[model samples]
Target: MIGVIATMTVQDGNGPQFEAVAAELIEKVRAQEDGNLLYQLTRSKADANVYKFMELYRDADALRAHGTSDYFRESFGKLGALLAGEPQIEYLDGV
Candidate 1:
């Protein structure tokens, strides 16, 4: 299994827009991606503008499929303007 924690910082007052895009993508991922064990978005308690994507994939191929999916790409494109900067990603191996 593969775990990923993707940290994203949104521009001031852009949280709603970012969340909307993420929400749509999350729905699609949940409904369409067979190899995705989990795909959830979480907001930081300390900062509303900070969010993280917690993802669990069945394997490397599954992760790659998610990364290359059309829905993922389109959603990310929508988020570009709302982001403060590049997203930070952390990959982990399941114990």
Candidate 2:
């Protein structure tokens, strides 16, 4: 199994837009990606603008598939404008 944690900070006044787009992306990921075990969006309690995508994949192939997915790319492209800076991503191996 593979775990991925991606954190993104939204630009000022862009929270709603970001969440709306992310909601669509999450729905697509869950409905279409069989390799995906978990894909969720979470907001920081301390910082409303800070968000994270908590994800789990079936394996390396699943992770790769997600990376190359057209919908993932397209959704990120839409989210780019709403981000305050580059997203921080961390990969982990399941114990």
Which residue pairs collide in model 1, if any? none
Q: What shift in Å separates residue 58 of candidate 1 from its native position after superposition?
A: 0.4
Tens-digit lDDT string for candidate 2 (30-89): 998899999989999999999999999999999998889999999999998899999999
**TM agreement with the true structure for every prediction:** 0.96, 0.97
Q: Write the per-residue lDDT of candidate 1 for residues 15-44, one digit (tens) a residue.
A: 988888999999999999999999999999
Spell out the clash pairs found in candidate 2. none
> Against the unseen true structure, what C-alpha lDDT does each candidate score?
0.94, 0.95
TM-score of 2: 0.97
Q: Relative to the unseen true structure, what is the C-alpha lDDT of residue 79 in candidate 1, on a scale of 0 to 100?
A: 84
The lDDT of model 1 is 0.94
- The lowest-lDDT stretch of 10 consecutive residues in candidate 1 is 75-84
